[model samples]
Target: MKKIMFTGGGSAGHVTANLALIPYFRQENWSIHYIGSVSGIERKLIEELPDVRYWPISTGKLRRYLDWNNVKDPFKVVGGLLQAYRIIRKEKPNVVFSKGGFVSVPVVIGAWLNRVPVLIHESDMTPGLANRIALPFASGICTTFPETTKSTTPGKSRYIGPVIRDELLQGKAERGRELCGFRRDKPVLLIMGGSLGARRINEAIRKQLSPLTSRFQIVHLCGKGGVETKLESNNYRQFEYVNDELPHLLASADMVISRAGSNSIFEFLALRKPMLLIPLTKGQSRGDQILNAESFRKLGYAEVLPEEQLTPDSLLERTMDLYGNRERYKETMKAFDPGNGIKQIRDWITTIMK
Candidate 1:
C-alpha cells in the first residue's frame, strides 16, 4: 500500500484542506498518517476519523520581528523535527504533503531529510515565511492564486485553487438555513473570522448589531475567544464555532462578512456568495492577508478592507452597498470559481504513484 504523511495546523483553514484529501486518499487504499502540534485546534476535528493516525510535534512560532521569543524557537523547531523524523522512519511513507503553517515546518524538514518526495499546498496569495523557505526543497508546490507563482521559482509551482470540502461544492444554502433554524424569507448573512475567530471583525459587528439585526438574519461564527453574548434580537444566532453545518449556512446566505483567508475565499466562491472581506493587518503576517484580499478584489470578486479602516460605519456602508448591487456583484465574479478541487487533487496524487 502507498503510504503518505500530511502536516498542517493552527486553524480550520489548514485542517479543512487536509480533510479534503482524506476521502480520496482512503479510496485508493493509501495508508495515511498526520503530524500536527498537540495543542492545534485541528486535533479535535480530525481525531475521531478512523484509519488515520495523528502524531504530535513540539511546534514554535517564528516572530516576524526581532524579539526575545525568537531565541527559543530554534530549540522547539529542533525538537519537533526530531519527533517528525521518528514518525517518518516508523511509517516509511512514500510521500508527504504539507499545508504550510508553523506546525508543518518540522514535518516538511523531516521528510526532506529522509529523501521522501514532499509536496506543499499553499493557500494564500502571499506565501508564508515557512512556505517560502520550504518551496525550493519541495518536490511540488500547489497554490490557490495566479499571483503566488511569482514568489516561487518557476517549474516547481502550479495553481490548483483552494482545497474546499465536498459539501460546499454541492448546494449548501437550503441546508444551512434548516440547520440554523433561520427563515428563508429574509436575507441570511454569514459572519466568520476563521476557526479561532477574529476579535476586530467580531467587535465591529457587535457595535453595529442594532442596525444589522434590524435589516438581516445573521449567523456569526465568532472565534473561540470571541464575546459570546446574544444581540437579544430575534435575528441572529451566535456560536463560538460551528463545524457540522457550514455548507448550509454558507449556501443559504445572501452575503458574507469574513476574513480574506484563502480557504474562506474558496468557500465563498464555491457557493458564489457575495462577500465583504476584512484582511488581517494588525500584527497579522506582514500584509499576507492584505495581498490575498487585494488579489481577489482586483478580480472584482470581493471588497477588501484593511484593518485600520474596518470600523462599524465602514462595514455597515460596505455591507449595504454590496447588498444593494447584488446583481452587478454576482456578474463581476462570474469567472472566479474553481469548481471542487478534491477530484483534481486526487488525480494529481494518483498520477505521482503511477
Candidate 2:
C-alpha cells in the first residue's frame, strides 16, 4: 500500500485541513500516520480516527513574545526534530504533507533530512513563522490565498484556495433549528470565538445579549470554560465547543460574528454567511487575523471590527449593519470561486509521490 505522513497542530485551524484530506487518502488505501505534540489538540482529534496511526513528539511553542518557556523551547524543538527524523526514516512514507504550525516545523525538517519530499499548506494571507522557516525545505507549498504567493519561493507555490469539509455543505437548516430549540421567526446569528474562545468577544456578546436576541436568535460557541450557565434565554443558546453538530448550527445561521482565522473565515465564505469579523489584535497574534479580516471586508464578504476598538455598543452596531446588508454580502460571496482545493492538493500529492 502507499503511505503518507501528516503533521500540524497547536490550534484547530492547523489540523482541520488535514482532517478534510485524510479520508480521501484512506479511500485510496494509503497507510496514514500523524505526528504532533503529545498533549496538543491534534492528538485527540487524530486519535479518534480508527485507521490513522498517531505519533507524539516533544514540541515547543513558537511564541512571538518573551516568556520563560522561550529559553527552554529550543531544546524541545531539537528533541522533536530527532524523534521526527527517526519516525520518517522508519516509516519511509512516499511524502509528508504539512499544514503549517509549530509542531510541523520539526516534521518538515525531518522529512527533508530523510531525503523525502514534503508539501506544505499555508492557510493565511501571509505565511506564519513556522511555515516561513519550513519554506526552503519543502518541495512545494499550497496557499489558500492568491496573494500569499508573493511571499513564497517563486516556483514552489500554488494557490489552491480554501479546502472546506464536504459535510459542512450537507447541513440541514431545520435540523439545526431543532438541535438549538430555535424558532424560524427570527434570523439566527452565530457567534464563534475560535477553538480556545475569545474572552473579550464572549464578554461583549454577553453584555449585549438582550439587544442581540431581540433582533436575532443567537447561537454562542463559547470556548472551553467560557460559558455562563446563569445566563439563559429562550432565543439564545451557548456551547463550549461543537463537533458533529457544527454543520447544522452553521446551516441555520444567517450571519456570523467571529474571529478572523483564515480557515474559519474561508468556511464562512463557502457557506455564504455574511460575517462581522473581529480579528485578534497584533499584541495577541502575529496580525494574520487582521489581514484575513481586511481581505474579506475589501471583497465585501464581511465587516471588520478591530479588537482594540471592540466594545459591546460597537459590536451591536456592526452586527445590525451586517444584517441590514446581508443580501449584498451574500451576492458578492456567490460570485466568489472557491476552487476545488481538495482535488488540487490531492493531485499534487499524487504527482509528487510518483
Candidate 3:
C-alpha cells in the first residue's frame, strides 16, 4: 500500500493543517503514520484516528531566548532524532510531510537520513525557527504567504496557500443561533483566544462586555481554564472551547476578534468574515503574528489593533469600525485568494513518491 508519514505540533495550529489533509489521503487508500511528542496537543488529537498510527517521540523546545534548559535541550533533540530515525526505518513511508514545529525538526532529519523525500509547510510570513533549521533537509517547502518564499533559497519554497478544514466551510448559521440560544436581532461577534487562551483579551472583552452586548450578540471561545460563569447575559454566550459547534459559531459570526494566526486568518478569508485582529506583540512572540496581521490589513482583508493599543475602549471602537467598514472587507476578501492547498499538497506527495 502507498504510505506517508506526517509530523508537527506545539500548538493546535500546527496539527490542524495536517488534519485538513488527512481525508484525501484516506480516500486514496494511503497508509498514514504520525510522529509527535507524547504530551503534546497533537498526540491528543491524532492517537484516536482509525487508520493512522501515532508514534510518540521525545522533543525539546527550540527557544529563541536563553534559559537554563538551553544547556540541556540539545541532548534532548539528539535523543529525539535517534528515536525518529528508528521509527522511520521501521515504517518505511514513501514520503514525509511536515507541518513545522520543534518536534518536526527531528522527524525531517530522520526522514532525510532514510532517503525519503520530505515536504514542509510554513504558515507565517517568514519561517519560524523550527522551519528555518529544517529548511536544508526539505525537498520542497510549501508556504501560506508568497512573501515567505523570498526568505528561502529560490525554487526551494512554493506558495501553496493555506489548508483549511472542510468542516469550517460547512457551518450552518441556524444551528449556531440555536446552540447559542439567541435571536437574530443583533449581529454576532465571535471572540477566539486560541487554544491556550489570551488572558489580556479575555479581561479586556469582559471589561467592556456591557457596551459590547448592547451593540452585538457575543460568542466567546475563551479557551480551556478561561471562563466566567458568574456573569451571564442573554446577548452573550461563553464557551471554554467548541469542537463540533465551532463551524456553526463561525458561520453565525458577522465579525471576529482573534489572535492573528495565519491558519485562522485564511479560514476567516474563506468564510468572508470581517475581522479585527489582535496580534501577540513582538515581546510575546517572534513577531510572526504582527506580520500576519499587517499583511491582512494591507490587503483589506481585516483590521489590526496592536496588542499595546488594546484597551477595552479601543477594542470596542476598532470592532465597531471594522463592522462599519464590513462591506469593503467582504468585497476584498472575495477577491483575495487564500488558495486551498490540499490538492496541490497531495499531488506533491504523490509525485515525490513516484
lDDT of 2: 0.94
TM-score against truth, every candidate: 0.94, 0.98, 0.97
Task: Name the TM-score of candidate 2.
Answer: 0.98
Candidate 3 lDDT by residue in tens digits, 1-354: 989899999898888889898888888899999999979989988876779999999899999787999999899899999999999999899999999889999999999999999999999999999999998988989989989999987888988988989999999998998898978878999999887889999999999998899999999989888888986678889998777798999999998999999999899999999999999988889999999999999888989999899999999889889989999999888887766699889888878862
Pairs with steric clashes in candidate 3: none
Query: RMSD in angstroms, all models?
Result: 1.9, 0.9, 1.2
Candidate 3 regions off by >4 Å? none
Q: lDDT per residue, candidate 1, 263-293, as tens digits? A: 8887787667788889888477667788878
Worst lDDT run of 10 residues, candidate 2, spans 226-235
- Which order, best to worst by lDDT? 2, 3, 1
* Candidate 2 Cα outliers beyond 4 Å, as residue runs: none
Q: What is each predicted model's overall lDDT from 0 to 1?
A: 0.81, 0.94, 0.91
